[model samples]
Target: MEYEKQTEHKHHHVGYGTLILIWVALIALTSITVTIAGISLGSYTLFVALFIAAIKSSLVINIFMHIKFDEPIFKVFLIVSGFTLIVIFILTFSDFIYRG
Candidate 1:
């Protein structure tokens, strides 16, 4: 019996323009985060910073890290990790709230 040869597939490449755009977006978000930090938003400051950080991280992971083009397992792992982080944050906040 003859075995069939597997063909190599080419992966999609991200253009420099797209990378530059993402870089600019990340810079803008960083600036916004810094500006928000300078102002007194009371208890919402951390939340706002974390929210911006989450966005920046997502962009980096999906684009720069090529997670967007990776397999479904990678995407599933990303979601699971994000969910775990959320749970950890919630538990930490709850502990802080319950502390005397």
Candidate 2:
């Protein structure tokens, strides 16, 4: 009985190997992006920085928040929330950007 319980627990233990690999890869990519940002990219530096930040945020949400494994309804809610946030952000930024 003890051996069977141990086996069940072992089977239920989720491995972090894949998550670690994803984290390391994302870290490397972020480092590369930061390095690239150091060079002169004309007027696109801000956009590039924002893009990198978005990628990093996506990795955190998918992994730490477990959004990737969530149900369809949860995914829909997440997607809607993300889009709503983006819309609000864009609206606010536009107001500031066009203040002139």
Candidate 3:
């Protein structure tokens, strides 16, 4: 028997359990990082904040934005944007580091 595919745009209910867990984990981690930043960590505090922010952004993009299920073109756009951001950061840091 040949099975016919549905042509209409059907909204499949994806289980939110996994997504909830991931979001909760990200929130917990971010809270802990912020709590730690409150302490006297000196210069390392900046690095820690940046790291936490990056992780949170990644979670938002991959899970909430549904980038993981997106097409290759979207992935390529993400990669290009990420690389561009990295290049800009590097250049800015280079200027700061070299400033007399």
Candidate 4:
């Protein structure tokens, strides 16, 4: 019970400065994404967009959602989730490529 209470009271607060920096970085990434979209990178375009989006998502998950400050189990869950998503993407892409 005490352990539960302690865990419940644990709070991770992100600083305003850090949040502002993150916001700025996110905006810059968005701008880059837009600029890239307008270009004809062809085969590499999807990879670039997904890479930037993944970075933005990780930043939001770690800092804004405080996932980094959560319990180890949560981190484990995140890892498993990410792995599953990667596998799914790989399989889907493989099928799309091979079907042609």
Report residue 75 deviation for candidate 4 (angstroms).
0.6
lDDT per residue (tens digit) for residues 29-92 in model 2: 7897879788999767877887888887788777666666554787799889989988997999
Q: Per-residue CA lDDT of candidate 1, range 1-100, in tens?
A: 1211211121246778899999999999999999999999998999999999999999999888877876679899999999999999999999987999
Which pairs clash (backbone N, Cα, C closer than 3 Å) in model 2?
none
Query: Which prediction has the highest TM-score against the true structure?
Result: 4
Error of 2 at 79 (Å): 1.1
User: Worst ten-residue run, lDDT, model 1?
Assistant: 1-10
Judged by lDDT, which candidate is best? 4
For residue 14, model 1's alpha carbon misses the true position, in angstroms, by 1.2
lDDT per residue (tens digit) for residues 19-69 in model 4: 899999999999999999999998899999999999999999988887877
lDDT of 3 by residue, 1-100 (tens): 1212221111132248867888898989888897987898887787788888888888888767767655578889999999999899889988976999
Report the candidate with higher TM-score, 3 versus 4. 4
1 versus 3: better lDDT goes to: 1
lDDT of 2 at 57: 79
Candidate 3 lDDT trough over 10 residues, lowest sum: 1-10
lDDT scores for all predictions?
A: 0.86, 0.76, 0.75, 0.88
Cα RMSD of all models vs. native, in order, equals 4.4, 5.8, 4.8, 2.2
CA lDDT of 61 in candidate 3? 85
